[model samples]
Target: MFPADFAYVRARTLDEALDLLDEAHAADQEAKLIAGGQSLLPMMKLRLAAPQVLIDIADLPELRRGGWMSSVVGGSFGGSIGALSTYRQLGRDALLNGGVIRGRNENVAPHRAEGVPAITDVLTVLADPQVRARGTIGGAVAHGDPASDLPAVLLALNAVLTIASRKGRHPESHLGPYTPRRTRKEPLNIGKREIALDDFLQGIYTTDLADDEIITHIRISHQGGTASAYEKFPHPASHLPLAGVAVVLTYKGGRLTDSNGHVTDLADGSLASAAIAVTGISPRPYRARAAEALLKDAFPTQETLAAAAAQVTTESPGSANRVSLLGDQHASADYRAHLAEVLTRRALAKAIARGGRSL
Candidate 1:
């Protein structure tokens, strides 16, 4: 739509999109995928991200739909993601939809449930109503924009990304040797299958999107055995979190669960595992595993929680936006780190409480 002289081609379905791409550029790498146009258009307009050809994958119903997808940890498949789902759509699917922090209609309530706390509390700061209306979860994720909130959440959730091209498919019949436990919801996908989140995501704005290939879906899970939480420092003007953290824990206490299971007693299991994914402070979301190790086995208490909160950051933090609170505003990186630690402690305490505070 800008000064770029790129050709626009719309396909009615995902297969068609892939087929068209396959035909146009069998081995070429100049085609770009267009879904909601929220991420693509902006970059195009600014001339920061322009492609010679815009392949519209919006028409794919598979991308727009939902499906059941999950696999056993240390077993087989991981999860699947339907390509077309937008954040708005996934936000309303009833399964994933709940108390949104800042949704225009019904808010997705942030809750500490099953095993871990919810990040819906941070959603209110993602963006304005108008911007949200147009943004898709897929778009936000595919772009891998460091500043985006949902992207970091997905990372902490350990979300798996699905990609496909007219050229080839993934290990359809066999999941790789490594199968991480389901820490989030099972991904529902259309094209290829779910690859581990680490394997699925290549890098910042750079992925394994093959020639004429695009991401079809993403799947995440926080099944039983995992407790998690999210916290964010938002930008007042855009509601975007300058720093966000998503924590996922694998508790063997037989207490930690997800949106579907029940909480029991930690004494029932004897061991636990937990991890945190962080964003807004780095180029991409990162895990706060080192901080988590400090809380494991340590019975979650107010004091311990506070102590744990102090350890949220071991790495240097990025810059806060040029804004003020009352007169001059600046939530120093140290403050954000402290806040992240606090949220982590709260979420962990909640998890321990659900387990009867029994170490």
Candidate 2:
């Protein structure tokens, strides 16, 4: 399948890309930003998307740089991953793979008990080496594929996205909490807006991104003692998840110590917070708030985990309403619902185990 004829424009810098997008907007011409082209190229070849102009920004340094970034506060760790960071880059990142994070005060670096298992697990099974090498994290998010693995993990982790656009034009509004990081100076500057990943993804192949805007970074914060993991059932041929679940859990309470000062297994603790997100079963990946409500303040027992898993597809916090799920020849609605429940249970168990008895 040959793609429709389109003009290709390679952007020299981030600003140059924004300017090109702005020009396209003014002329009412369709323009799409291309990075790894792992997502767009396929759609273009199938004639699913036929934009008039394609702006290449794969070589922009600002979009390619990423690593452990300082958190907004002390005694915690967070990351500001460049949107264009590929799956391979993320898989090898030390901080994200359970390495010790050195704070500004070098003497008191915090050790992450469990690195973000959700991300690492996704990278391991996302696709073949070829796709993982060329697919950009930002592109995957921006593309908003409903069955994609990473977005569900981001939703569970409560990740934030930094969006950029030309000055004088504000990012879209009424999409959850908005955090703006820019000055009001009257110069030709860039406008940066931060939005929760939950609100950013609206539906299948749809997002809150404006035509003139580009995703700059995906930021995540991990507090001490928090744990997370992802579990999925992928289709045999494509390796895309048939049903995927990501769980992030936080616990409150201290470990028990015996008279000899040895830690015991009798520590009393309760869940402080729980974020459960599921994908591949619905029109869009969604947070399993009903399941979260069930786990909040509860002990992480096998029974409790099972009870919460049963509600992964439930719509309300305390009701029997189920979400409208997607069904196809690959998996029926009933089968997907079943997979969501089973995978959610496994994900919660894995995350709890990662936290150990201390959690």
Candidate 3:
């Protein structure tokens, strides 16, 4: 199964890639950007996508860097992940693994009680080692694959994506209605737009990315007294999740106590907030707002947790619109919904436990 004939352009830099994409658009030619090629290549091979141009940006150094930052945008301190970062890199990142926070004022990094467990957990199960090694987080999210694990994790984390485009380079400088001027030597006048992870994903294989835009970074905040975990039931053959849930819990005053009820970790005892996101059960991953609202400031007892988990469907109370559950040969809609609840319970329990409590 060979792909259709296309012109392959290996871009040396981000600007070059953007230029090529712009040219393709101006000419009305179908073009696709290639990073890790883990997602796009397979679709091309199957003849599902046959773009006339394949622009490779894998070698662009700017997209490969990943690190912690004091502020990614609007004075929010968190981790800034380069779009080209692979699952292998994310899985091994110390900053994401847990409690180490890099302070903006000083070079010294402080250790915390917990790191981001949900990300590492998802990375471990997101396919075999080979696929994980080559799959870029940006590519997976940009492709808008509902079955992919990372999008749901991002949703639970309340992550933000930085989308870049060459919008301001033209001499008109109107920032409104302007045409791009072609100049090989002129540096790219890059503009950025930040979108919430939940808003960025529209539906199956769809995103908010414009034709000339590319995802530049993913930003996730690390708050004190918060922990996250991911759980999934994956298909045996493809390893894509049949139902996956990512839970992030923020507890304000809960002390890590011993079996005798003695405070072990020296903390408070109040649940502040909870966020749950589920994937692989619908056309797109979505935040379980009803479930989250139920758990907010509520003790995560077995009964309450079960009640919250039951609200995993998009049809939960206060939902804006109804979303149909996706059914396939592998799993029926009823069963998939059931798995969503089960996995949500498991994920919430694990996340709460990581916050030093058990239900």
Candidate 4:
């Protein structure tokens, strides 16, 4: 199948892309932005989406910047990632891999909360080399595919997204006399709005992004004494996650000592916080808050972990009508829900073991 005939425009600058989008919206024309074209191209070829104009922003210098930057927000030091960064770049970057923990008190142990193993772990098995080479982090996220690995990982990290858009252009604007007033062509100083990653994903193939907006950057906090890991069960053919789980644990106090003077117990003061996010099971990826609450302030034993893992399916308690599972040709709802519990337990165990001592 071939897509409908469409006009193509390549944007040289970020502002130019914004202006093009604004014009398309004002004229009441369907326009889509293309970066990496990994997701959009397939949809277009299948005739699922046929836009009047395709605005290519792949060459925009602003979106192409990739590197770690020192970020301090609300007295917490962390890192910011440019949205246009490719998966390959993130996987190979030494800073993103396990490296020196920066912006922390010297007294803190380096192994506790080191680098972003959660991200690197996902990248290692995300897709094949070809896809990783061309796929951009921003594109995968903006597509809002429920099966994508990064969304769940980012949610577990409590990451924040910076969306870029201008105030004058509205997606609902039309070209008639009732058309909204257009502002003068000013320099492309995109107005940025920060949204939490969990809130950003509204549903399957849906997001909080306005039609005219684009994701500009992502920010993640790097708390000391935090350990995180990602695990997934991929579809045999596509390698997309059938069920994926990310776990982040923050530890406090000294190592735990058992009754016999052995230091293998994970007792009360061992874990400070726990964050778990799961994907590829329901209509959308979600944080297992109910399950998280069960694990908090408790000993991380096999029994306790099993109790919490069971809660992964009961996203909300006392709601008999809630449909927490999603069924498809690949797997039944019951099977996926079971997989979620199993994967969550495995991920939690690995994360706890990793967080027990420095990487």
Best by lDDT: 2
> Could you tell me how far off, in angstroms, the CA of residue 52 lies in candidate 2 after the best superposition?
1.5
State every prediction's TM-score relative to the real structure: 0.70, 0.88, 0.85, 0.83
Across 56-100, the per-residue lDDT of candidate 1 in tens digits comes to 877776566545432223211234456676555555543243222
Mark the 10 consecutive residues where model 2 has the least summed lDDT.
179-188
Instruction: Candidate 2: give the clashing pairs.
Output: none
User: Could you give candidate 4's per-residue lDDT for residues 306-333 as a string of tens digits?
Assistant: 8888887676544334336778999888
Mind giving the per-residue lDDT tens digits that candidate 3 earns over 133-175? 8899899899998898999989988888776677642232223
Winner on lDDT (1 vs 4): 4
The lDDT values for all models are 0.57, 0.83, 0.81, 0.76
Measured on C-alpha atoms, candidate 4 has an lDDT of: 0.76
Candidate 1's C-alpha runs over 4 A off are 1-3, 23-29, 69-79, 98-119, 169-193, 224-228, 249-271, 306-311, 315-359
Q: What is the lDDT, from 0 to 100, of the residue 327 in candidate 2?
A: 92
Candidate 3: residue 34 Cα off by (Å):
0.5
lDDT score of model 3? 0.81
Task: Encode model 2's per-residue lDDT on 1-359: one tens digit a residue.
Answer: 99999999999778889989999889899999998998899899999999999999898776775556444343246768999899998887766776565556767556543467778889887989999999999998899888989999999888888887774344355443354554344134776778888888888898988898889889888776677889999999988889999998888656688899998664356888899999999888899999999999899888999999999999979787898898999999999999999999888888887777532
Report the C-alpha displacement of residue 293, candidate 3, in angstroms.
Answer: 0.5
Give the TM-score comparing model 4 with the true structure, all chains together: 0.83
* Winner by lDDT between candidate 4 and candidate 2: 2
